[model samples]
Target: MKKFWNWKNQAQTENSPAERTLFLNGTIAEESWFDDDVTPQLFKDELNAGEGDITVWINSPGGDCVAAAQIYNMLSNYKGKVTVKIDGIAASAASVIAMAGKEVLMSPVSMLMIHNPMTIAMGDHAEMQKAIDMLAEVKESIINAYVLKTGLSRAKLSHLMDSETWMNANKAVELGFADGTLTRDNGGAENSNMEDAVEAVMFSSRAVNNALQNKISAKYGKQKQTVVQQSEIPAPETNERNVDALLERLDIIKNHI
Candidate 1:
């Protein structure tokens, strides 16, 4: 767990009337970026702040992939609904973080870019091959996240990533990268269906749910394992039923349009 910025301290010293208490902002490319100790703490504090939706403000050029992944997981597994707002740009690993949000909201001028994972490696031909294989595996994992969030075809998503696609707010929403654009006038009504999808996804994969639990326990340094019992797991049939119901709802909405 990393806490890169002391957002609370900054807020106290430089209070802004327009700032929401739950809004968090950080730059991934700046020096001292991705401070492991500070970023996680801020996220924890916000998560524990009571029962309500959270808005995460991102304006990053992207940095440490591991750190970004951890933070993204934390937000995704949180009990409350999480909305991500890309205020400026979310590139590379930052794009992964954006996908973790329950409902992604972007400013009209915001941008998002995604590309294949990259890493520096020093090794022989065999070792280099291994590195390449690992990178491919990692890319698949990242692509799964995007597919789960957007319900987009894997082939299309892979093509976009390969092209290092850059998306504007309208394009993002059209492509399912974002739920919608945010208005300066007010924070609009939260979407109940989006909230349900977030909760459903948390319970959909046993591995993901377990990983999240382990991360939380490690964060608190608790020896006790928080195991989700088999009976608690959502059945595959139930998931299919939910999806069918969602599709029906969408069809009804379309009829009204």
Candidate 2:
């Protein structure tokens, strides 16, 4: 089985802080960590192998919520400060892991998304109902982590999740999902800033839908205008003759009546 995380030790320098860099680059766990005893233990051992702060770089579309929850618990319980930096996108289960960071920073171009928990069940009506209940409980559990970090109301968070909200760096900071935005310094080093130069910007499925609608309207609008212009043009001489013939027939019929 493949592991989902990589660890790198960075030497303490006078100009920078000493920290271990952990990269979570793909799916949370390609294979279930709970299935075997060895992998989880190995992950814990490596995490505890060093001292000082930890810098976690996350870039994942997310997978295996349970595995992500376990990772979150481990990072939250660590002795050193945990700082999470999103270099790409963190969606679904990966977003839960991001909540474990004491200070979460996002790249200016990175994205974060949150949505309701989902599962597949194969069984009768009772089993389906059970799955539904289980998913609701799981959603609540995930919300606990977000609430702790963002201090946002549960109702608001739930609505966001229901809508599958996506947020950019500034929007994440504004919503308290992130503490700030991460940028490169003059020394070609990464730096986190609380005050991003750009204002908070929100990106959602609704906005995408609206833009698509606008494009469709613009595309069809021209065609509709062309049809209207053609309709307004005077009728063909053949059509005029046909109309005159009909009018003469009507007059003859009236005279006979």
Candidate 3:
């Protein structure tokens, strides 16, 4: 619940458009082995606060997959057009979220990265195979988001993901990941063509695991009643392996939230 990506609305005048701003900075899920995260529920609440065109600012390393998926759906479902501006980098799950925007813009030196989904498992071959299948489907679902926005073919997107593609502002625009590079002046105002004010970066949870779980459930719901109950079969319990195993599972689970 308490992660860095706080959603806040800026004050607007009576005649100004009811523009809402979203800041996505940091990991996408709560328990990040690398850094902190931004949970999905809080994001949903922040996203629904206003009723006008929205702009999101993102700078993140990326985290949970399902959390990013749900956020993407929410933004795509919004009535108003959405614009995304990348300041630093939108890697992995963060890049997926960027695809939801109708117009995506990037700072001249900013970057975007995409790659395959990852998970950890300790079960026998059957369970391990299930994990692999789940990850593959996750990758496919991510590509769906990209294809919808960029009009890229499934084969090409898959290849890009496999390669862990990293693109710069111009390349992103050329590839359709971004509409254009943001044009600003010494006074920090957007060039004559840009009408909105630049949003400040806000340093941005555990809900990611929940979202990942939900995603897996939706795909494998037939297994929910059985698996959610019996999937906890004990692993060989020991001091070191137990800790490592739990951490790995957490690494994989937080994306659902």
Candidate 4:
């Protein structure tokens, strides 16, 4: 079975602290956790082998929510401080694991995404309902993790998940998904030119959507006010309603990407 995590021990230096580092890269738990018992045992053994602070470097698209949940629990209960550093993208189930961190930091160009839990089910109406109920419970459990880390209300977090929110580093920090952005002064020297190039490409899609939203709002704001004043019509209710609907549609479009 392919391991999802890699471990390394860094010796203490004159200027830096000694800590174990774990890399969680690529798709998490590409193999099902329930397939065999060895994987979890090996992961737990490696995690418990050392003492002192540990830093987890995450760059995953996310997979296998059950595996992520087990990892999160282990890290949360560990004796040493757990620091999570997102160096690329942490989305879906990976975002749940990130909440186990005592301090979560994202690279300036890193991305984090959260969405409602999903599953495949094929059966009669009763089975379909059971699947839906299961997913709802799973999403609630995931929200519990987010609530603990971000202090965001369950309703707000649920809405974000419903919309499949994607956040950049600054936004992540603002929303409490991350403590802060990593920087050279903060011992983050791993970000290189190549990573920046990749970030540029990945971030462009979101940038365009944001720009479009702003442009539409700005152009319509003035027009809406002008129409109301010229016609003496009670346009606020209608215009506001339509604007909200339009923005919701835009969000739906953006989320699909």
Which candidate comes out best when scored by TM-score?
A: 2
**Deviation in Å, model 4, residue 195 alpha carbon:** 20
lDDT of 3 at 194: 24
| lDDT at residue 57 of model 2 (Cα atoms) | 93
Instruction: Estimate the TM-score of every prediction.
Output: 0.60, 0.75, 0.68, 0.72
How accurate locally, in lDDT, is each candidate?
A: 0.66, 0.85, 0.75, 0.84
Better of 2 and 3 by lDDT: 2
lDDT of 2 by residue, 142-210 (tens): 999999999999999998998789988889988999988877888543556645366666656765776
- Name the runs in model 1 displaced over 4 angstroms: 1-51, 186-257
List model 3 lDDT by residue over 163-183, tens digit each. 677777767776778787776
After superposing candidate 2 on the true structure, give the runs of residues whose Cα lies further than 4 Å from its correct spot: 10-18, 188-197, 206-257
Task: Name the lDDT value of residue 17 in candidate 2.
Answer: 51
Q: Which stretches of candidate 4 lie over 4 Å from their true place?
A: 10-18, 186-257
List, residue by residue over 69-151, the lDDT tens digit for candidate 1. Answer: 77678778877677787888877888888898888987766788787888989979999999999899888988987898889
Candidate 4 has an lDDT of 0.84
Could you give candidate 4's per-residue lDDT for residues 32-95 as a string of tens digits?
A: 6856578888899888877789999999999988888999999999998999999999999999
Q: What is the lDDT of residue 135 in candidate 3?
A: 95
Off by over 4 Å in 3: 31-39, 186-257
Clashing pairs in 2: none
Instruction: Arrange candidates, best lDDT first.
Output: 2, 4, 3, 1
Highest lDDT model number: 2
